[model samples]
Target: MQKTFKLLLVILTYFSASSCDDLFEYHPNQIRLDSDERNLTATNLERLQKQQPGDTLRLIVMGDTQRFYDDAVDFVKSANSRFQDIDFVIHQGDISDFGMTQEHKWVQDILKDLKWPYLTVVGNHDLLANGSKVYQQMYGPLNYSFTYGHTKFVMVDTNGREYSFNGKVPDINWLAKELAPQQGEVWQQAIVVSHVPPYDADFDRKLEASYHHALAQSNMVSLSLFGHIHNWNTDYLYDNKILYHGTTTVKNRGFTYLKVWEGGYDIRRIAY
Candidate 1:
């Protein structure tokens, strides 16, 4: 009787310990932040500042990381393992639920564990009321450009007027001038990254056609990528150019990884 009681106590202790471990595991791989708090932290700012030109760049493009924050974290972890040399990460918008401060904080905490530089584009959901201001304060600029290795990467503001239908969808003039091949430019490849595509029904029809036409003339543009559709695609808008609309980090949609070699670029999807 004494031996049986002791054995039962030991088993109970073991199960209790296991339960505690599971409780604390709190992987939160499925949790996402709200909209208002998507700003940059001291660490993310430092990483962004350290990036230099002419480095082999490996980046993960994630879409709609707001409601599916945990899934996004899972994707990030998987990406970190596969692309050990990634210089940075680009999130193509929807970083939060309501663009609230709490949401931003949650995401920042999750991303704090990542070992590489990461940045985000503004999405429609991220623009809820004061979302743009919050995002700008957190990540720096809305629309900007950076050069890496033999590529010129442009991050633009497509969600500026997401709350309404206006002619000022994307600054087409700015994009055209930026895409112009400069004298002795070492960047043989150019890519445009936007939160919303010109063809997305969210924008005004006139504005979409105008922006689309402008992009068609930019011969230097090798790839045009967008989010907001919540799925992966390879859309060819022109003969020599291709547009890629990657899926979301929500609903376990996965991420888009691009490999740019001397010959060409290859995009692959990873399920987190």
Candidate 2:
């Protein structure tokens, strides 16, 4: 009888340990991650910088991956099958729904399967709970810019409503500075990318004109890209010179393919 009891205790102990390690989590908001999951922005940017500059820069623009794990996985498969000469994939934001680290990790796990490196913008939903911190830790800055070939991409944080319309969420000063020198020695074209469009009610009303004016006046900024609307749209809102492209959500199984050269760009909507 004592032998039987000892065997049962051993089995229980093994399962208890296993449950602690695999099944039970202390908290859903915990910011735990492996080395492979951290500092993804810099890692991907390094890969992007190393690629040869082609005449036509082909990229996949998709976003709003919130609460859509199954669809996001399918998106990876569809994106892979659709394009071959793509440079990289740009996720416009909402990497998480509840701002949970696990959601971000799940999305990353799926997007990591892509044959090309991917970049992300900070979405309003990504600011929930400890989401902003997790996003910063995993993807780098909320507002950042990088130049590839002759094109410079300026990604900013435009989730004004999330900040209660604090008027500083988009950081117009930083954007103006980034847009000031459009025709840099190396880069001649500029593209602004963000989550919430300035036209959206979620954007800070006070800064909307300034934001649009910044892009409109920039000789280098010919196009701006955004997500959060969950619908495809193309417009020349402010000056009729700057083209703004808004992408749909991954839940809708749609994305935009962008092709840009030195002087012009083209966009196509793809649904799968």
Q: Worst 10-residue stretch by lDDT in candidate 1?
A: 28-37
Error of 1 at 190 (Å): 1.4
lDDT of 2 by residue, 152-225 (tens): 89999999999999889899999988987644258887999999998999999999999998887777798999
- lDDT values, one for every candidate: 0.69, 0.91
Q: What TM-score does each of the candidates earn?
A: 0.76, 0.93
Candidate 2 regions with alpha-carbon error over 4 angstroms: 1-22, 182-184
Candidate 1 on 99-207: residue-level lDDT in tens? 7645766677677667786777778887786777767776667777766667777777787457477667577788887788789777776788888777677756667
lDDT of 2: 0.91
